[model samples]
Target: MNRRLLALVAAAAVLWPAAPAQAGPATPKAPIPVDTYLRQALDGTGLPGLSAVVTHGDEVVHAAGYGHDSTGAPVTARTPMRVASVSKSFTAMAVMTLVDAGKVALDEPVAEQLPEFRMADPRAARVTVRQLLDQTSGLADGGVGIPAAEATGSPAEYVAALRSGHLAAEPGTAWAYCNANYEIAARLVEVAGGAGFGQYVRMHVFEPLGMTGSSVGGAAADGHISLFGAWVARPELRAFGARGGAGGVVTDADDMGRWLITQTGHGPQLVRPESLAAMHAPSKVRDYAMGWGPSDVDGSRLLVHAGNLFTYTAVEAIDPATGYGYAVMTNSAGLYDDTYEVLRGLVALTRGAEPPPAGGQRQLIELVLGLVALASVGLAVLGVLRPSRRRWRLIPPVLPALVFVSYPQWVSILMNGRTVTWAQVTYFAAPLTVTLAVAALSGLVVAAAHLRSIASAR
Candidate 1:
């Protein structure tokens, strides 16, 4: 059965939707070699599996999976994975649907729908729904307050806390990345739809786009099929509260492929072409829009977002002008770098362009420096083995490395308040540098003492 399934998957890969013949003749269909690259990338990242889809013009460039399933089951294009924050785009879409219906005004203050919402700054009451969509909400999302684990409480309670949280800056002053604002907008979605937010999305959004495998915050009642072996039933994954508007989506490559098509205005499933253009339209925040971020990828305006939820990561992007897009989801977060590369490659193939390769002097310098630093520290630590252990010496090599990595990310954090780049630098610098410095210094001191003792004996 597995072999047959694999064969079927391979066949589907070749026979997937083709770009129109009007897309400038046949253009000689060549094997993109993306599957092989994806496999190798996944191997290095320790990601259990990945599913990706690419569309060129109207053609489905590729839609396939590589590696073992999230649950060690056979991975197919249909394997459901939590899309994490990527669901934010869908949430924005849902809210915009209400906008289309004239059920909610984008410029209206959110306090009109949820009267209980408040913030530390009285000016926060003036924050409009459009501000939230654009991520200009100046709420305090800093410090160790927010948990890294999955949120398990009622969505209402979670949103209430976010609404009542501190505001470090007035709304529209600067961009502040916070999930709370979206959760609040989601509450508005509930009231506007007169149904559970997830159900409304399912009925209007997912079902219409043929995203049957997509669910906000969880998989279906039948559970998700693993890419390698068996069905891992996730009742909790299915038990999403009202937070579906923020980060509660479970979907696969095929479904997302359909979404990418619709996003580029190739299909008439969701909103109109004008609305999509509006969604992709840039805001004051860098690369930010109504629900998506805009950037010039390969010389064309592209809408993109990457989702993160603990071990899982997903990214999706579309270039409406080129009628090309890509969706990539990984079951493990460790493969983030690989995921980015894979997504880039798929997009390049669809767009019929090769992206600039990543091998640069800076990357080489960092790689060599990292290795040399690691080896030096490791050797020093080996000489400092004490049974009871004692005070350790500190090394200076870490200071340079820390400064090198932290400064840019710190600048980004200071300028944009987005934790994505900020958190990356912080996570890689602080603990690693501190630990290695201590270890190397202690080892160097122990070695010196041993050498002095030998000299005295001689």
Candidate 2:
């Protein structure tokens, strides 16, 4: 895929919530064909591996794994995978637990709890616990210094990095999804709860929810597949120690089912109903709650969260009204939205309807773009070898080359003023991006040579 298409897909994968559709009446005991649809989706999407689980109350209606991991190991419900921003929900719950204990208040200034939490912008002093969980603290993604800090830096150092950055808007005035908000919130948990952020989560959240296999700071699953069906391993976010609250929970599908059950008001009552309700309610921004987005799926108002860490993607959703929930995880990197596709298919099956065919047009478009880039490189070389007196002939190859070289800047502009890194471009769409880069550089070389030939002839 070209960079523009890739950016659009990436944005949709991360930013957009699934649209609400009218769902059929909930059956007290409905049998969903999760396994049948998941297997077909695995084949259709070209994913290397996936794990999924559907839950109703405390019962696991369906749980299964398809395909193999990077090591050629067979996938199972027990296979661990990175859940990315799904971790945000876990962090938000941890904070709520402290609130229930009267150890922290949602509306209190975060700097009061974690004294080191300061930003270069004075408006940051007014940032509160609620704003942090709701992603309205004004510390936009691109400016957060966590991207530059030690991947294993302490929470204090993470806060210091954030302190050096400026806010994108006044606190509580606008909504911006910033990881720094969670990092600071996690730091508050460390200070108030008097334990390491990960340890605190393990004790208060994972342990209580009976999620024994879950933990924070684990590496992303190894066998992440690219859109072109090539195996690519994404580097573990070394800074997970600092940003664990934002996107770092690692767990298997079975544990995820249990977690989902709790969220849907079934399973163990680890958290009080009122507290969970608060987390699920929309914050000042109508689009996002604490860590979840309220979306309507098949007539059910489902609280959903989808996560992408470039290497692995995950989606967890619950319909409290129906006491049903599901979670899906994939070992792949790109803008394919595999998690959403699988979840939607399963949800449709539960409603006794067939989902439309999985979309593969994006992948096909990318393949065509890759071939076009190669063809441009070949034509550029040919033009250099046999210079055309008609300089206008240079426009075709030269124009695309210029566009390709300047594409990153365009992407940065589109991504809420965040700078695009070479590593990010390579991770999101490696095959097409690399080909474009090579084609652009080669085309420039040929253009230079062709211009020299014209000048020499004169």
My TM-score estimates for the predictions, one after another, are 0.71, 0.89
The superposed Cα distance between candidate 1 and the true structure at residue 126, in angstroms, equals: 0.9
lDDT of 1 at 384: 41
lDDT of 1 by residue, 301-408 (tens): 678877655445678888776788888886643211335556666666655565433212222323433565566666555544432122233334234445545554
Model 1 off-target regions past 4 Å? 1-47, 56-59, 143-145, 148-152, 219-243, 354-458
State in Å the error of residue 325, model 1.
1.6
Instruction: Give lDDT per model, in order.
Output: 0.60, 0.75
lDDT of 2 by residue, 1-458 (tens): 11113354654344334656859765454443677678888888778889999898888888888888877888899888888788999999999999999899899998887788877788888889999998888878666654574344677777776767888888888887667778788889999999999999999989988898899876445746474555576564334532478887899998998898888877687667999998998876657899888887666578888887767778888887777788988877664566777777777766667754554644654566577667877877787788766687666557657867777777676665555556666775566577677777777777787788778889
TM-score of predicted structure 1: 0.71
Model 2 TM-score? 0.89
lDDT score at residue 298, model 1, on the 0-100 scale: 56
Residues forming the 10-long window of minimal summed lDDT in candidate 2: 1-10
Model 2 bad stretches (over 4 Å) = 1-6, 10-32, 150-152, 219-221, 237-243, 298-300, 390-407
- The per-candidate count of clashes, in order, stands at 14, 7
